[model samples]
Target: MMSGLRRGPLASRFSPSRQAAMKQSVKLIVGNWKMNGLSAALAQAESIREAVGAAGQGHRVVLCPPATLIDRMRTALAGSGVAVGGQDCHEKPVGAFTGSVSAEMLADAGATVVILGHSERRAAFGETDAGVAAKVEAAIAAGLEPIVCVGETLEQREAGDAIAVVSAQVEASLPTGLSERDFAVAYEPVWAIGTGLTPTLEQIAEVHAAIRAAMVKRLGESARTAPILYGGSVKPENAADILATPEVGGALVGGASLKAEDFMPIVKAAA
Candidate 1:
């Protein structure tokens, strides 16, 4: 266990109902389409819905396509046991920002979840931890589950700062509003996303354990049950091993998610 994570009465005092709920918490498998996905992709979404319906329960599956496909995918996947989500949302519910989508708008468009603070957003658009916290609050207010992301680059890992850096990001980026709401945290090492490389299971376990400790310290016992998802170059071939890692509550898949044949195997692994 990481420092400060030793169980105290507070951590061990969950009620019978809460204990059962925690034990039954389903694995969450999310597919992030990112800047890919067009209307034509709805077919893939339908196929996944069909597969998951046959696969039965034991896990939760969500698909986050570009904003353009949120509504269409939601409609197509209706009653199929799959959920639709947005890639990002503005912290404010409404504004003249012209090009930004708000959490309320995402909810209105049929998105039940929103991904915030992805490394791409942080590195490319200069998003700060405070900014992600603000967005988390907005998503909660709008009734959308937020999946807050945090990670370190190769240089930071090489410098032996991966755990510390990611721990700090988890502390700063997650808002208190998330304490009672459904949400997830995704750890996607900047160096591994789309690189066809992955950290050893030991490394993944280390970071995920650190993240869980950070979450519990910040949010108390309620944080203990929230899923901590792994992301990067996740695919069917490696999904089982990664998902089997201790503290890994699920996966956040990228390119491989674009096709049902590729994505379903990962979901099956979680199931």
Candidate 2:
């Protein structure tokens, strides 16, 4: 005989049918801690772990702290089933470059992924696509997946050249042999990032589909399984709709990721 008790709403949410759909694959939710954090910020990771708990089993969670905190974040997430990454890395394996951390060093520090060509890196530091390409290749050489970011500015979008601009950046930033494995790409419009402006669902679909098409052209079958994440002002309220759009596999959350309360809902939305 079976017990007559019923399952709780939260427990019943991930039904066997739903679990099958989720499986080993999941929507990725990555937090770009970006130049922020000290040893104290490890608490944020703990809070995030608590908030996620077992409920986030259906989604992949990544936390990217500044280089200074990557090792610490890695340790904190050791048994939490979350992954830690770096905000940036150098193009060379090792060199005399001051204030630059090499991809090899990041890999040594337990960073499985690194973000390259972020808008801030481009606008503030003047990073060119060629330079981004070098960094991507270095990261790949060191066995770190590079989350290559590509998008256009508000002016470019207004001029209707957003697709052209991002396409060119993709071609220049991505290295050869992209079809070898499923890497990550994030599309974050410069003007939308942290600016509280989000592109419409139709707009997001158009850009993401275009990006996927470009990937297929460049990488063949491997492009089909690649995870393309959307960034720039992603919020819980809009996460579901945006993620449901074609080619949008997950998100690279910015301001919203700073708080567990704000970020968990987005994870649920993706799940």
TM-score of each: 0.92, 0.89
Query: Candidate 1: where are CA atoms >4 Å away?
Result: 1-25
Give the Å error, residue 43, model 2.
Answer: 0.7
lDDT of each residue in 1-271, candidate 2, tens digit only: 0111122354257764443234224677889988778898898889888777756455778888889888888888887767788888988888799999999999888788888999999999999999998998888888887788999999999999999998888878887755554467899988899889999988998998788777767666445556789999999888889888877878999878877888888888877
Task: Report the number of backbone clashes for model 2.
Answer: 0
TM-score quality measure for candidate 1: 0.92
Best by TM-score: 1
